[model samples]
Target: MTSIPKTSRRDFLKLAAAAGGGLVLGFHWESAEAKIMNVIHGGTVAGSDISFNSYLSISPDDVITIFSPNPELGQNIKTSFPMIVAEELDADWTKVHVQQAMLDTKKYERQVTGGSGAIPHSWERLRKAGATARYMLMEAAAKRWSVPASSLTAEHGVVYHKESGRKATYGELATDASAIAVPADVKLKDKKDFKLIGTAVRNVDSKQMITGKPLYGLDFYREGMLFAMLQRPPAFGTKIKSVDAAAAKAMPGIVDVVTFKNNVAVVGKSTWQVNKARKALKVEYEPDGAAALESTTDHDQIFKKLLDSSDPNVVSVKRKDGDADAAFKTAAKVITKEYQCPFLSHSPLEPMNFFAHVRPDGVELVGPSQTPDMARNETAKLLNIPPEQITLELTRLGGGFGRRLKADYVLEAAELSSLIKAPVKVIWTREDDMTGGSYRPAVRYRFSAALDAKGNLVGYKLRGVGINAGNCTREDNFPSGAVDNLQIESIEHKSPITTGAWRAPITNFLAFAEQAFIDEVAMAAGKDPVAFRLDLLAKAKTTPVGAIKYDIDRMKGVIDLVVEKSQWGKKKGVSQGFSVYFSHRSYVAQVAEIEMKKGKPVLEKIHAAADCGVVVNISGANQQVRGGVTDGLGHALFGSLTFKDGAAEQKNFNNYRLIRMKEVPAIDVHFVNNGIDPTGLGEPALPPTGGAVANALFKALGKRLYNQPFTKQEELKGVSLGERL
Candidate 1:
């Protein structure tokens, strides 16, 4: 195997060691995979220079720095991602610091840092890197002490020669250790041997967060950088016809006000000045799509129309099993429920911002985003430059929640600044960030379960409607023959809203709709949800659901863990809800305890269990689960995007709601401490929260909410979706 050239990563670490200060690896080259495996695992104070992918760096001082790829918003990735390296490197956990890696995709693949794929996907690789480094260090120690390397053991950033009882800090062996050959096929620590994987570690960036350091996109500024804010069209698809920048140009500190094809941008010395000047600019827009937009407010009627219209078009085939139509006709009982989940904005704490310095040779870009590689490609294309010329420096994001997945904002900022041949920081006001944001599509799910006379589930049919993300048309997804008969269909409801991946996999909304419906079906059959789920899982393994979008056994494992910890069947007084989901190579289970707090079903607590393969940092993993649950709470309790005349109605936080600390109950997270491997914590917990909360709400009212934002709106009729307990 061609090993990673030891030159790139180690070169920088050696320099940092010589300086005698904390070493920060701000990777920007793109992919660091070319580096050898052994260099990564060895503990050291010397950190190597990495492409965009490098997050964790060990100093000659043995201080480990993890440049967090994902934006923090509130999820504790700053701490969690580092925990993985700490686990593999066997470094002193307390010495770990999570900084921000720059946006360079070649360096870090999928560093977009959403969909809950980070820790899980990186688990094995990161640990292996750390282990490789450790092996080389052992060899160096053996040569110095005149003993075999096998006799030396590593623990807490020190290499110990067991024979002589001599120990050396990681820093002491940094130089000699670099000369050793990269160990081939190193031994990885088993799950049973993990000290950090199963235990909760404090977030490495917590102190910096609390101290209000210069973290997040908005905090990013540099010498001679201008601030630009756009005065976008009042409505979507409204193109700029003409602009008169005379008045705005007179405003003090205003650098330039230029009109692009779609909107007008006001560049000035500060964000405040540009924002103030933007409001005063004069521009004419030709409204395009607004004329075709529906003015009706009856979203319910629209949902009904999509549901009853029978058209079989497989826009994207996700899952299919048995002959659902045949089983439905012969079933003794047919229970159908229609549920609707509204559109939601990610609403990360720090609104989108990017700094770009456009030069004749190359350009520099900086910001927080989920898909860093995508951002690089998009930015490069917009600047009319090659990817190599555009440097994207990743910063600690305030939050991602899948919002940063699309890099339109990054492109817009860079494009505007590149045209002017100057350094500029594009700052999006909360309104633009919200209204102009890419939103989670409003979705409608129709689920029907057929049961035999003996109460054995025979068939299932699902009709789902949304933006399709795949196409304008919806399609069937239930796996073929997973049941005796299964029918899945989809329809398209066009919207101006742009859709991207949220917390879990592509079918997050559908998973919740299906799982929650299954719970209700179990109740109808007077059966335990777990028992019913197990029965389906058993059949699923033998004859599985629509397309096997989920793993039955892994789902069963997480469910069992949650059920055991939650005391599922015995839940009383307060309504208890349970749900399990599998997506993004991760399986997760969640149980939410709900009670009436002044009529609304307050999410009192959440018990979550996840089999993410391996636990890199137990505390960090738990933190992701905790944050994901709360994120789902927001989606369930109050996250929606409304449009009128082809423009988003919610302009800012006041109109678009978010779950605050007051609404956040203490979340309890537990990991399946098996040595299976690792997945991600960012999104798994989100998809399941909706299912769990909805099920609990079903028990409390004996009424099911078909749509999300379980809020009190005139739309839900008299039975408010968020009616108090």
Candidate 2:
């Protein structure tokens, strides 16, 4: 048995009253030297205190309840995190209950759920929590039986003295355990002894979701709550000039019409009524210098100008090693190509919506948010109230591809509720969500590579241009340290259109550009794509040039696994493309099989190999990988959010195409079996999907796609592939 580290004395466990008369336990990690204390104190338990920092509780009937601290945005953390605690506690899996914790930074540190960091950050702490509680329960049972603690063994929430044949249930000993002092140090179960950690446990909320239960933000409703809709500026960089709401206010079910800083608000009894009334309201906007902006023409000129500019101030060096210019000048052969991707919309199934009730005492917000603490703090600042006065309840999010990280929708609901002096639920229609700004920034990349006479890679240079958001290229991106002469430069182009993180952030475009260019280089060097990448991985593993952000061994691990699983070059009938990338501390490699159909590449299947460390829920992890692959394929095929005269051109799914079931292919996912701590699986699987598909298109059609949305409507109509090829 390996002993866990001892906590300091300042760390105390509080046993308080819980709802339904269960045992409520709260623990806090205040300092580095803090340890769980033994003192038991009694006081009137308030509703908030019942669950305040109360991660785990045992009921009188031996039922254990675990509170999940992180906000769940369909990542399955609610089920996975509880399994970590249950494994260490040796609790009965069937007897466990899971609940979502409120946003309280004091109790739960770093409650934000972005970057796929919840599992790694909470692994050790949660295991320690469960171990501490198990030790306390065993000690209490041993003391009552007048035996050495070593004689006791716990299994399935039962503490038994094997020698004396005396057994006590955890619920039966809860009262005594509450008074026992927490052990300074406790032992943790080894990986080989894990029962629930690696097991296939169903999602805690799966039943509720399948049964159409009210678990999402849009399902939330309160008595006497009014529905509100905002008639925002038609385009970016515009403000309200005048408003006319006479006919809107007179409409049936319409309550009132109000003007706000950016838009007009229509309040009514239902979402439909508010939307109907909002459509009837007449409003004029004052252009704010963005009315002349156009995505199709202006952005093309902007990117071209930036690429051709001689201003040194516009270009920033992100990474450099040796002399790239000299290597390129003296190279035996050089290959240069340019790639670009348009802006994208998240387009989550459930549009942005929130419910807020503001009063003199405090403000209560219930909705789906990726960053509840940030939303609460921002709302507090806007309302001129203390942060403590703002209460935020997180509901299950339909889908958050990094869009929910922004608290603008939450703040909007709070502001409207404050002005109306009533509980209000603000709903953003599909049009509002699609047309609203904060899209994924459009990016362009120019890649040049130099190779020696022996076909050995020597130099690589990349110059990237992104809109408004500075650089979309990472300094330590893949193949950075793999080459001796390498340079990465980025230029920023200002735009009025707001931009933000998409599913995988900059890696979404960066991986597509880098991997596609790598494939082209492999073709030019007369080497297999997989073999070429493996050679680079071996170089990075043995002799690296600079700081290596990724583990070379892990990179090789996934690539080899994917090559074997995909049967690269072994499949006789299908054309395949291979790609591997690292992001969010996880490595994923994908092989896409495609065939040309009506001059467009039709996906046949995608085989993936991932090394995200230990697998928590095999079923859920596979689902995530499949979903991510599908999302990446969908967007890469024909997804683009464009603008003309500062207004979004694609206002709905009809034009802004998403992958349908017919378009998605069967995905076979495999994971590396190792003892490494688990990394996030939500994002890493997505970045390589695009690259794999693009490479497969080239293999199938002998054409290189320099831009995204590789297949357009005209191309799909059996147009010749001669133009792009």
Candidate 3:
């Protein structure tokens, strides 16, 4: 059971008086402190000076509107977030309305939604918002009936006096409730009493989404809005030298052409017209000052050099425990392997786009942004306007996968709008979206493990090399805490190629590298992969080394569950592989079942066990886990983004591969309901999937794959869902 700290009744009364003495029934809660007060009365807002710090509003007619403060990047936070508030409020599910709140730092904390943080960040505050409103309703009923507030119980949007057989709907008491003193503290429902959280609720926007409703940033429209398409440098480390837009401006439907920074923008009445004109524009490029013009070949050679280099300038120790050198010296066997994954394009279904209306007095911005607060701040800095003068609204994002975290596209729209003195919607074509340099950094990991003559693991070492990846090693994750002697180091090459977070960030590929290497070591030790991992976990639980950031129990729980669900060793004719990872404070374990068909490995199914604390909207949670697994598997199988002379070789889907329906394996998702606060679900399941599949592939192929895009290998090339032999 959880309890919310109360704001004293006396303090709330003082706040009401300060807000002109009307009924103010909500508290502006921030990081365990109720700093301000706000209220709405009879469906009209009452406090202008007050920051609406709460997530919900109750009006006459008992309608409750819950505001989802974070961006919905196809993660279903739009539905699940409000479900949490409604559950705590004990409000009727049918009567709850959810709205996407605009960017307001004071009203909502942590408006950014990347890193699977939306639920974990806002969980307690949303629950308290509901409880507070429920408390107010009960107080209003107590005042009307001349009874003690404690004598009335609130449930399902009603205040009831059981002893007297009296009841009042929240709608009937809303007006009076708005005037009641805000409660300082309220009791939260225990986990056993959760009514809506564990249940599967369909996406709130499913109906609108399926019926072709205009909901995404691409669907956004304004009466006089102009469409824009930009021509950026053809390759990384290049900038615009000169532009010839006369031919583009002569095209029909093309309103104007402009240049800003390194981009040339063609603004027109429609996307089609702008795209046609954009192709007509002639632009010259020059090498950017001091930025290296690199290619995939260059990066490959660089990674190899850095992995071998001992220069302190190239390698930085991320974590070091007992001397690894001594442990390896006494070991009977040493297993060394190198794993590589290429830079990847986010390739969201909806390409990058945003709408900006920059006016003299204020700015009206609307689009799909995973970090609206960051976008707003960056836009303010670019436009030389106060942040307060900007109003940003969020639209349903088609997909993000961490690409929207950057405000580059948002700034593009704002800059064009400001220059043209009109509202503009900046749209990136599929070619632009893919070739644009904000890619997942190409990374390589070298792992060496030492085992004693008795077959017990003694030492582990990792050296990571990456292009523009700030920190490539997850120093504290897994084997770090379990191993006796461990050393993790990172080597970075600052390429001119831009890179940023993609899904689970470094863990997306690192988990695979670490787990695959662990599997190899287990094989060398003649131990079952599952049993080997469990033994290490047990050792860590009993006597951990250094600092352990992950919850051992949670990780073990998922591993056990996946083993049971996948029937690990019981299923014949199928090669089985196991992997578990902890990220974003959530644990996920996956088992991939593979079978050789027509001399190639075909992934048959994946069984996944996730411990994301208490499940909120089980349907959405299942989809998230399954989607992450599929994404990870597809990328590992056939995704690669290579550069030739700093130009991305793959421009669109034709060359850049994605999983097809036939190739996607069936996935079973199971969640552990430990009745704890929800952690992130968006990225946790993704990290372990690649490792699981690769381990399974090893079992089926009798060989190890050391690089991603397993298709790159001569034998695995064109591997797909081949028919069973």
Candidate 4:
């Protein structure tokens, strides 16, 4: 059971003996939140007690505490999610305190963050939660005033009796409010009535960040903790034959050099000591087959290979419209283009780290993890403890971009500490973090289309190859089935490297490539790209993206809104090209102006627009929009991770360049100002940027760029032309 404090800027502390001596409770709401008057109950969402801690909480002090289950990796959900509930709670924005909800899946299940689905998925549930609490408080006040519920009105955390001019604050009714059963169907406010939502709000935690409060995993601290760094294989499929730990064991602060699982780990009093000892320790091993992996696979080659190859196991076909094959066969003119994007890394500012205290009965984990649900299960497996005994304490993330979802590092920490018989924290150096694996799987995409005798639209076809995304961001459970005629296939060039979710999952990369190709088709047909996309959306919405893809109408609505905002088909610069893409239930369109100077592409400006249904925490949503766009720009310019003789060639930022301040052109973001519940604006904004830039580049150069390492053609020198674009 939880209790709300009666004073402003206070806290609700739970002090149960954790089944047998667990964590202590201490929390405080900042003074700024004392004026909040919203009553928001977390339970009764979809009629379940399991998710009570998910959306929002209230204290007797009038402080509104909003729960954001997902990790805050500088994307600003800390502010966005709260603004959503605040809109319905009628809580004064000045009195709201956004809380970092723990990684308790049983309490706030589905806390894992990725797919840009955080806010959109939680929108209705959170709003409904707030609305229900308001109803409960209103009922309590209505009874006290002996007035009809209809006659009593609530605003800004206060319930008022209009006729009598009497009022009771939501906090004053908190005690009585808790005793009542939740109304069967709490009434929600109409969209037009919203105040906080659909409005740009500043980030709730920005001040804390600028002030250097302990927010991310990098700032995590524990009493008497030992640090460890794992020694991974130099290449995939290789194992250490033996290790020389003599030098490491003698080093100061070096606790022990031990082997866990297949890798050697050096433990120390500090990260620097552990890292220093790791370098001093030497090992030899038998390398894997990927040792011969090369950066030589050019764009055109792999794209064609994916098309002509017959390796099945294509798990999904997301979308297809009309008789594509027949249209292509009968067309008067046919143009086929191929595209390729190399592997990428999440490379979050804070590299992966985890703190674990392993006891005989169970384990406790502290640090940042996107999926606490998965963490519980995986930690249970590694610790050989009951799933119930494992407790996960999630902290704020420096960054994720889909990397923290995997619980490998958490398990590793627990396993190492359990053996050492002490609390331990595992830290990855920038080098270890990069080489440790689980990167975005590189992909090859091929697109083809046909134009009729009249040059009207006839058909579209797509073939994708390389590592399958099913290995990571599996959407088999999505509302819509996978693609159609879409022919999404894969061939695994398995390496020792592990791969997991990155950004919007594998479908998004395909969307970026496939959508850009479709844009080209529309241009070849002399049809407006926006209108052409709408036609496809109409078919997909009515039909479906094969079995399941996503909400088609919602997707189209966003795209349409973007076109209206971005002035689709209007030329900013005749040489600039534009494209649009949809992912995670959001649509984004970008028109990039580019110029070819001495064979180098220079982007001049970008106009971006999106429809996320509703806008929550305007500042945070806009930040994500801008950040995701810039992330795409960096990738389009020079970000490409390739393998050579089974080793990743691009070691760090020097070679794997990100978009710097100088490269970022003027980016303009506009939203569909509707308070129709909240939707997210993270990864959805990224998928379209590359395609838009590529399309723009084509418009400027009069030739298509269908390969990655955009300018690293030398790597593909000896590679087969079919495998190199």
Model 2 residue runs over 4 Å out of place are: 1-22, 29-52, 290-292, 595-601, 713-725
lDDT per model vs. reference: 0.69, 0.82, 0.84, 0.66
Best by TM-score: 3
Q: Please give the distance, in angstroms, between residue 503's alpha carbon in candidate 4 and its true position after superposition.
A: 0.7
Error of 1 at 180 (Å): 2.1
Comparing 1 and 4 by TM-score, which wins? 1
- What would the per-residue lDDT of candidate 2 be over residues 1-725, giving only the tens digit for each residue? 11111111122122223222434555552221113322222432323322235357676678776667688888888888888888888998888887777677777776877898888787777777788888888889988999998889999989999898999888888767877776666788887888878777788888887878788899998999999999988888777888999999999999889887787999999999999999899998878864455556789888888877768888898999999999999999999998888899999889999999999999999999889999999999999999999888888899889899999999889999999899999999999999984798898889999999887789999989998767778879679888999999999887778888899998987888889999999988889998998898888878999989988888899998999999999987588999999999999999998766666556788999999998888888998899989888888877998888889999998999887777678899999887898988989999998899888877887777778876663323453432212
Estimated TM-score per prediction?
0.87, 0.93, 0.94, 0.84
Ranking by lDDT: 3, 2, 1, 4
What's the residue-level lDDT of 328 in candidate 1? 85
Q: Which regions in candidate 3 have their CA more than 4 angstroms from the true location?
A: 1-48, 597-600, 715-725
Q: Compose the digit string of candidate 3's lDDT tens values, residues 1-725.
A: 11111223334334324433223433343542232244544333455555564445454555565556688878988888778878877888887777676778876778887988878877887787777777777888999999998898878888899999999987778667766666667788887999998898888888777888778899999999999999999899999988999999999999999998889999999999999999999999998877878999999899899999999887999999999999999999999999999999999999999999999899999999999999999999999989999989888899999899999999999999999999999999999999984999999999999999888999999999989999999999998889999999999999889999999999999999988899999999999999999999999999999999889899999999999999999988999989999999999999999987766677889999999998899889999999999899889877999999889999989999887878888899999878888988999999898889888888887768789887686545555536311
Error of 3 at 223 (Å): 1.3
Tens digit per residue, CA lDDT, model 1, 1-725: 00111122345455454545432323222322213322432334434334336644455677665555555555565565666566767888766655555554555656656656556555566666667667767887899898988888889989997778898877677566756766556787766777776676665556556777666678887888899998877765567778888889999999998777576889999877888899888888776745444322545567678677745452333445656778888889999987777666767778888888878888877877767778888877776678888777677777776778788888878788877778888888889877777777667777899999989888777777665344321233223335767656666666555666665534557666777888888987889877888877787688544455565667778888998988886866788888887666777888888777566656677899998876666666677788778777776777778777667788887877777677787678777765676666666777788888878877776767566766643343465333222
**All-Cα superposition RMSD per candidate:** 5.1, 4.9, 4.9, 7.0
